[model samples]
Target: MADPKGFMTTPREEWPRRPVEERVRDWDEVYVPGALLPIISKQADRCMDCGIPFCHDVCPLGNLIPEWNDLVAREDWRAAADRLHATNNFPEFTGRLCPAPCEAGCVLAINQPAVTIKNVECAIADRAWEEGFTPPRPPDRLSGRTVAVIGSGPTGLAAAQQLTRAGHTVAVYERDDRVGGLLRYGIPSFKMEKRHLERRLEQMRAEGTRFRTSTRVGRDVAADELRTRYDAVVIATGATAWRELPVPGRELAGIHQAMEYLPLSNRVGEGDLVVSPLCAAGKHVVIVGGGDTGADCLGTAVRDGAASVTQLDIYAQPGADRDEDAEPWPTYPKIYRLSAAHEEARDLVTAPAADADARLFAASTLRFTGDGSGHVRSLHLVEVDAGRRPLPGTGRTLPADLVLLALGFSGPDRTDGLVDQLGLAMHARGTIARDAGFATNVPGVFAAGDAARGQSLIVWAIAEGRAVAAAVDRYLTGSSRLPAPISAYDRPMAV
Candidate 1:
């Protein structure tokens, strides 16, 4: 380790976030400006570099936290980036987007705040790109085989990069106008800017991954035609099916899905023209669901000058620390955490900020009441127990000009022309079912990421991508040397 007594001597300190008041004015990334420089080497030096790291076990990617932390502490940032890239193809993306299960799994976190593993990893990646440490690792010899990846999300990108580097011609297909899938659209720029994704895409391009956006397989091109053209096909199409609430007034104007609202704001940030736009401006916005997606909506609406915002969660508020039965050490904790959005909302509702109403936990929506004009104007809500059954005498009416269902996704868009025309089988839960090698029942076709696993972490998506690439390579060549970071049959390993 860089500092022998670093863990004992230094307390953890992290990069500071930009002041909320200043950041909400614009759509620029909320953290990057002031977040990168404070590498907090002393904090990195806190890593024990344990003989058997639970952090790795907890992380879906199994990132070498201690190795990179030590490298960062020693000021060997290039080597740190190398170690980081060994497991994660796009640390820039994961560094920004992932919730850092590794930190939660840290042995040190049993007491202290744990090593700043995620921050160190992101810092190393940023520094590497700045110092010209990252370069394309083009294959020396070409394999005559070709592979097609159907989806340009993290999974597709990683699979394409790995396959392209392994000397196979690879093409990534995205249905959206641009590549990067959800990264390009679903995710808001406030948490992570588009530049991180763009830079990584540039690297993948240099390494010879051909990208074909605005193209949907089984629509633009027949599924069978793609199979005949490519040596192998990997489906990384993520779960895009939004879980809808079936309450009354569901189809009314001013009621929108979370994806619909989030993407429009993101697109607006991208300088795109608003066509029949969904704006939260000067409206009383009520978001139903208490997950990160809901928090994201809260932030976006606040920035858009929503007259008021209220978030509702069906479950009771979680504890500030781990609950024994729910989350144990080395597993991610189930606890009440205040996100930046929650903080901003608190600032609005409780303090000086102009507008914020409430975040009602254990609250369930009974129904939406609409004016005769067919626009949503209010909602009937009730308090509920842990089982989400309504409590007696808890019903009340709340003003709601706009209701966003942030309840989360059910699975991929199975009804889309692509899945329907191809006749892909979905699991009972609506996710595509794949075997140990990520192969679907359909021969020569494979699935991975959220499309197969349902809504999941970015780390899992990338791991699934790398694993699927290995499977595809082996299928085409009858053997493979690619790193299989995960297999469909593999679960999180425990000691």
Candidate 2:
């Protein structure tokens, strides 16, 4: 431990964000640049470095948190980065995007605030780049085996990198014009800038991991054809079949899915468009579903100059502190937390009838009302009980010109015929059915990430990616040395 009494003395501190007034005006990352490095070492010192670190156990990537935390506290940037990379392929992405379940499982979190493991990880990754610690580690020799990975998302990217370094020829196919699937279009720039993704892509390219953009597997190239070309196929295509609202006036104009609204804004940031065609400027935006996607939409609308933005969450507001009996320590608890987007909305007073953080808890959409032009004008809603049954006398309406449905995804999109053509078995929940080793019903085809696990965290996606690569490597050769952090059935600690 860096300091014997570090956990006792140190109060937790996180990276400060840019002012809401200033950050909302631009598409750059919300965090103040160069802010984390200064205070990250001190924060890492707060780790107890437990005899049995539950933080490591809780992380899907099984990131060596205490080891890296110690190195970070010592200011050993190179070693910290190395430890971070041992279990995770994209620390930059995870450090920025992951919700940090590890923090929840931190021993200190049983009472005091958890260690700033995410900040330490991000600092080490960023500093590694500045100090030229990260480089393309191409395989010493090729195995003469070929693998084709579908999708260029976090899962696919992680799988591709691992396979490439394991001496296999890997080709990652992306349907979009760019390499990153959601990271490119679905995720907003305010959360994480594209430069971090670009640099990682460049490193992957240098390592001989090929990326084929603008190529749909089932349309441009047949899925069967890909299986024939490659020795093995790994399906890391994320679950993108978004759930529907199915309420009256859902077909009204100005009503769109979160994916549809978010991608256009991302395109504007990518220089593909001067302004988003579906821009929410001067419109009353009502986002249904209180998840990360909804929060993302909320932030994006604020940046686009929405007149008002209200987020409707189906679940009631959770308590400020953990419910010890219901959700004990070392497990993620349902608690009220304000995201950056919520803070922006609160500071700007965007949601008129919402809570302090701009969320209407336990609100269920009744129906949408449209104007004479068939454009959505207002949304009718009602407060619901724990069972989602509407509570009488709680009916209300909010002005909603632009309504975004952030209800989340169901399964991998089958519109491209990838699942049908491959004859992959699917779970009842609409996820790809995989064996304990991440293998699909199809002989040489494997599935992982959201496709196999349904909608999940970035850490889980990366863990699945790493595990699937090891399975593929073992299937090709007799045995393998790759680390498989989680099995196909391994699930996160959930209530």
Candidate 3:
């Protein structure tokens, strides 16, 4: 337990973001630097460490939230880092990227604001790196078995690290030029700089995990060849095939998928390009979708100096507070909250009260209007009721020189021909089919992460990676001691 009566006395305090005006000038992270360390211990003390710690139950990684919270309160960062890394291979990634479902399941959330679990987790991870407490744990001896992991995202990285430390030779292959998949390209530097990823990859390399970059498994190297050479293979390729909107004028020049635009910006951060082809500079940008991806686009566009920005949501805006009747205790509820990007966009409003939020809820896109050059000119939309039926006299047009589709993903990208090569079966939801043991029908072949679980949070990806690694170890050695955090069917309250 952190502090016996601290939950009642200490109010929840989170890491503060830099002022919107100041943060918009640069592509660095939005948080106010050095503001978290002083107050994080007090915030960690707010954890009740309840009899039934639902925080652990909801976390896909099954992280020891209470134990770490107590350690942080006592200023024992080394022990807290150990407890954190015991389950999560990459706490820094989750602390920055995850939506933190553990906080939603907090017992304190029933009455008071939940403990700042995510911020404390980030603090411990950052401190560990600073104090050199996080060192490469190389295996004492080799197991004489080989494993090939497809993809270098969180899942593949976790599995490779776990297996390597457990005395197995592991090699990770990535299609991109760099090792980190979405972590290297899909996310912007402002959200989390690539240095965090680079540091972790350095540790993995020291632990003897071989990485093969710019190598497509099905094309550059045959998948069948890898299966023949290695004793076992694990597929962790993420869900990259994006969902599309097939409305009229969908082929306009200025319209693109979020993945297309985001990766370009990330390349610019890597010094590969001076300006992204889909740059929103000096343009009126409109984004379709109201999830975290949309918010990411919003922030990127704002930093790029978009003349104006508006986000569209098909569903109605969530309530400011949790609706208990709709979602009772222990269930993650949908509530309105301002993300860093939302806060930045809120400062750029010039319209009337209706458009003050820079977001339009119950909004449906009728079609896009284009100029003579086949470039997007404006967006045609209509306000809708609860059922999404367009209301009478609610049609309007907004200037939009650029349009981005952040409408999420459908399934894994099969264009690589890997799935066809393996003859793997897919679930009804279009994800890879896996049994309770996280193994596919093909013997010695397994799948994990978004490739197996569909579009989800990094936390779930890491958890599935750890679990699948244990299954693979057991298959290789007949018996294993690795911890399996969750089964393939275990879904958490996260994207």
| Alpha-carbon local distance difference test for all models | 0.83, 0.93, 0.90
TM-scores of all predicted structures: 0.95, 0.99, 0.97
Q: Write the per-residue lDDT of candidate 3 for residues 43-68, one digit (tens) a residue.
A: 99999888889999889888999999
Q: Rank candidates, lDDT, best first.
A: 2, 3, 1
Task: Give the C-alpha lDDT of model 3.
Answer: 0.90
Residue 210's lDDT within candidate 1 is 92
- By TM-score, the best candidate is 2
- Candidate 2 weakest ten by summed lDDT: 349-358
Candidate 2 lDDT over 292-315, as tens digits, reads 999999999999999999999999
- Residue range 1-495, candidate 1, lDDT tens digits: 788788888888876777878887877766747455565677788999888899988887778888988888888888888999999999888877888888889988888788888778778888889999898888898899889899999999999998999899999988888888889888888888898888989988888889998887877888888888987888888988898889887877888889899888888877785532778888889899888888889988988888888888888877778765667787787677777777777866721222233578888988897889999999788999988799999887778899899888878885546666556788899888888889988788889999898888888999999989889989888898988888786765333
Question: What stretches of model 1 exceed 4 Å from their correct place?
Answer: 32-35, 274-276, 350-358, 491-495
Which residue pairs of candidate 1 clash?
A: none
- Measured with C-alpha atoms, the lDDT of residue 335 in candidate 3 is 85
RMSD of each: 2.3, 0.8, 1.6
